[model samples]
Target chain A: MTPALLDAPAEDRLAAAIGEMARRSSSAVAIVAQAGSAARCTIDYGWLSRAIVSLEAGIDAGRPVGIVARAARVETLVVIAAACGRQHVPVAFLAEDSRDLVGQLRDWVEVDDSLSLPAAAAGERGRREFETVPPQVIVATSGTSGPPKLVDHSWDSLLAAARLAEHWHGLGWLLAYDATRWAGIQVWVQALLTGGRLVVPASRDPDVVARALVEESVAILPATPTLLRRLLTSADRGLLCRSGLDRITLGGEAADAALLEEAQATFPQAKITQVYATTELGEVYRVADGRAGFPAAWLGKALPGCVRLAVRRDGELLVRLSRDTAEVGTGDLVQRRADRYEFTGRRSDVIVVGGAKVYPKRVEEIVRGVPGVAECRIYGLPSPVTGELVAGEIALADPLPENATPESVRAAVLAVCREHLEPHSVPRILDIVKQIATTPAGKTPRKPHS
Target chain B: MRPDVPNAIVTAIATVLRDTGRDTRPIESGMLLAGDLGLDSLDLAQTIVLLERSLGCDPFRSASTSRSVRTVADLIAIYDSAVAPGAS
Candidate 1:
């Protein structure tokens, strides 16, 4: 494939595209690679072509010989995050320290840093300003931090509960997450079963994933709400519209009404589905008709006597796998909103600043009330002193605060929080971000205190 | 032991006290955090956190730290020994 068009000035990009198409593929690759080769840059097309060919051979042999991933310092993270295509060998990402967890997989192979490119040049390659987060994404790390999770699952075990539909036939499904991941594996099987196309992007970068979706004429897209938000924020609106997306499945994280409304407006043609799944429970529940959570009526109702969904008094969603099984906790909290139950946050989503419980939702609401604040997200940062310190990611309203610094906006938010919240609930850290980092699973680990 | 540990501890306590709209006067070494200074457990946590950032160490990490620290001096002593050369 020719080098993907650069997110440069429209006219300059067009000229560069025309010139590259004239000069040939390698010239086009060199131009893109040369533009930014200082941080972590995307793998050049020349390298990707070799990797794809190797990928085909590896899958045919049914053995994973490492396909050198492109990112320098984050090569392992890239391979783990993008676990690009359907793998015959079931892959599970383990934390570097969890040596024991590796035993859970009998034939698992570690995709190490023996990457295709040298560490020196790979790291030096350019990462853009828009790509705020490094390639070391949170989703790749201990999926929702606790005891390092080990999901000992195979294609058959995961597909045991899948409800197949004839409508899945011939639709192009975008592999928007780690293919080894539960959601990714499910998408792959659905595509395989339906004789449909699974468009696996070479990179998790929104630009690359969005381009693949559009260029491949992908009809079905499965992604986390965070990934969908990133795609909407990063991709050109016109380019996104070019894709014939008939279905958008959001899972792996909670989907809010605002995000649902935004996605609905962006792709009115596509039907949105909010699905919730866990490593323990394959695909727990699904909600359609453009709502945040499943219908309250679905609560306490058993799904074919296989998986029954219920909520705790404190709001955690509980699922009973079968008639004989005890209710298993999903760690997600849900709230009844008129006709439906909307997932509020995870049970552990609270920020306990010192000894007091500081709800992120409460803090986010107060932060959003500040004069210039248009949007805000609340999360905790690890601190030895307090159990965890409260942090806020704030996006400003239009007509920018005349040369506003993060410091200035933070000071204003601090003033408001102090009045409404307890002494311990005030956010210690605040960032004025253009777009909060949510591209790759927005759940940044609230690292346990030492 | 570092000479500035007592002074640093006092400063951190004062900072947390200021944020909570409490009196920021006469932060003596013998002043009990909860009793005399009116600093709650969370306020004490804030003080320890601030001290860790400024002093570049957390004594609680190496040595067993009691939740109920009686006075400012006890808190200072814990950190002072932590930063001492050859200290754990």
Candidate 2:
């Protein structure tokens, strides 16, 4: 599909917004109240231009730029706008360790302490000029390998992704504003480009967020599965059902079929869709309904100019993007069934013992049925004799009403798995963890066990 | 006690922090939530959930206000003033 913004230059709207901010700083609250009763205060756009100008001043002073940033907030948006206007490469930070953040931003010349954008330059009617260049953002990504890596994307690439996303989704966004990570960058820019309101929260509370959705009449919300889970659990069934949301899109981590089913049950009116994309690759496929598996109906549709997907010779998934010609193969294994393919967990997450192949998610499905087990991660660990054996790391929902032993939990999990799985798929050893390994977004971390 | 501070606010916050794997020993009021207790954003969300169940006021009402709270004292101060006499 032809992205609406593609015909025109990418920076036109952003440039116009910067000009507007330059003219009106004091008249309105561009970034609203962060705390107290004034927590919802809205600062004018001029304040944002001023913040950019001030931050640009630091960059001019040979300072590495470090912005304590969030997304969807007026300040954060302004800062992002300002940085883009000033042609400064903004290094977006996550809600991770500050020390780690500092280390990651070591190359930055000036760091803005304000987590949100500073609203100093509000309204000055003048010609606001910007120097465009390749994207210099040190974006944090959940690389195919380890604890996310920082990748650089030119402004062109990001802007293209935004335009493409807006075109594909057709609905404007009510960004979770969780952070300026992958989800945030896509949602905010697309909304802004389309002149759609970027709904910012008063807080991260599920109840508060739920209220905001109703109050704002937010049509679309892109969120992690964990956040959606908490939102559904925070109140009665009618909470999200009556809210006039059109679509609730889930991404970042893998989707749990049970949770998707729960969402469908709760919000019968709203369409529930699952999206799978990475920072390295802008959204590849937006699966309409992956509750059963990857939706085939949505496949073969015109992808953004940036994405192309195909199964590799080794049965893994491979991607080729416009930005990069080299196909970056993913760890996920897919088995084609006619035109639609089924996700067989990650190739690395598979266990093979005694010439038998097993997937962790298959084992997890069985373990999830066991009573008192909150969550589980299954992977293969090295065993001298079997080469590798199935292992499970389980987190109990709540201590077994006070007297539950690890042995009891293990027995329950194994029994459930044995009842469902074949002899080869049953976990040989199970370790009880206090909590499942999750990324900051709360997706269960399912690295290969070995 | 300060006019804004509640009688059991400190105990409540400490209990919440303990659930997050913080040292419960002599749970002090001055302990910083992230700096000293290793609590992250997720833990803060959990703390809000706990306080709502135990106390009444939600210290994390919106994103704008919640980001400023770095320490337990900071959180307690906000929570105390929110639940001060005659305030909900």
> Which predicted model would earn the best lDDT?
1
- The sequence of per-residue lDDT tens digits that candidate 1 reaches over residues B38-72 is 88756665676677778988776643765457888
Clashing pairs in 1: A36-A126, A37-A124, A37-A125, A37-A126, A38-A124, A38-A125, A38-A126, A39-A125
- Relative to the true structure, candidate 2 reaches a TM of 0.62
How accurately is candidate 2 docked according to DockQ? Answer: 0.01
Model 2 lDDT per residue over A1-450, tens place: 234434544434454544453464335333333321225454454665566666556444442344434443445554654465344445555544222554566434323346333443222322236434433545665433565666666556667645444344334355564455656666666654444455666765666677667666677778877567656655334556767877788876566667788778777777887776765566676667546346444343436565667677777877776544877877777766665666677776678776688888767767866767766778775543355567678877644635667667676676677678776677655668775655554455555431
Q: Candidate 1: lDDT over CA atoms?
A: 0.59
lDDT tens digits, residue span A68-125, model 1: 2323222233233233223322344444334465555443344445533222222222
The top-ranked prediction according to TM-score is 1
lDDT for every model?
Answer: 0.59, 0.58
State TM-scores per candidate: 0.63, 0.62
